[model samples]
Target: MAPNKDNLFGSKKEASLVKSNQLDSTVKEILASEQMNRERKTARLRELRLEKEALQPPPEPKAKAKRKTTKAQE
Candidate 1:
């Protein structure tokens, strides 16, 4: 039987395609996990800030000071 050149070369291409697909999936999963972690951290920080604000008293408003006017001619 004659050797099939198509099968011989096709196997290499198939292997590379499979490897690239796996890498793509892995990269996607990593990105998704990082995004989730960032969102979770942001939510936690927001919650902490709210809790801190709730524990603190509201700041008193400052009164405006009157400026002294000096009369030079009038």
Candidate 2:
């Protein structure tokens, strides 16, 4: 007998539901590791940001000109 619409679509629907559940669990497992890595990267980024914020511009030095001393002038 040829498959009816319900048999075909029903199986497809069940399959998609099972696949979605599996995908959700897999995603949760992957997120565990990714969460740790993300936390570490975020902490490093925070430290770098704080370091950048703490930095100050250096003070400018004064420009000095050379003076010519002559005994005739004195």
Candidate 3:
């Protein structure tokens, strides 16, 4: 039987390719997890903010200050 060179201890190029694929998969999973966590936190914060705002009375509108008219010098 011929020795299987393609298994575990394959050529450098093959090993590198395998490692690259594994790294890519790992990085993709990490990014997805972070994104999901960020979204969940944002939603929770938004809900809390909405609840707080609803409980608070609406703010009264402030009156704009009238600007003093400058007299033209002759």
Candidate 4:
């Protein structure tokens, strides 16, 4: 009987697919962590800004100007 041979591309394809999947998962995890950190920092900065605004005095209101009378108008 002739000797059975392994698939030329089958094993290679499976190994490549496994490596690709691992790489993809690692990249996704890293991106997720970065997103979380960015959101947390944004929230903290926003809170600090709000606190600062609360401690500051409000602006004074400006008075409305009176209109001048014209000679043409009796």
Best by lDDT: 3
Ranking by TM-score: 3, 1, 4, 2
Residue-level lDDT for 56 in candidate 3: 98
Question: Regarding TM-score, does 1 or 2 come out ahead?
Answer: 1
Off by over 4 Å in 3: 1-8
TM value for model 4: 0.69
- Tens-place lDDT per residue, model 2, 9-48, is 7777788999999999999999999999999999999999
Q: Model 3, range 9-33, lDDT digits (tens) per residue? A: 5898987999999999999999999
lDDT of each residue in 19-38, candidate 1, tens digit only? 99999999999999999999
Error of 1 at 73 (Å): 8.8
RMSD of each: 3.1, 9.6, 2.2, 4.3
| TM-score-best of 1 and 4 | 1
Native-referenced Cα lDDT, model 4:
0.89
lDDT per model vs. reference: 0.93, 0.89, 0.94, 0.89
Model 1 TM-score on a 0 to 1 scale: 0.71
Off by more than 4 A, model 4: 1-10, 62-74
Instruction: Count clashing residue pairs per candidate.
Output: 0, 0, 0, 0
lDDT of 4 by residue, 23-73 (tens): 999999999999999999999999999999999999789888999987896
What TM-score, over all chains together, does every model reach?
A: 0.71, 0.40, 0.84, 0.69
Who is ahead in lDDT, 3 or 4? 3
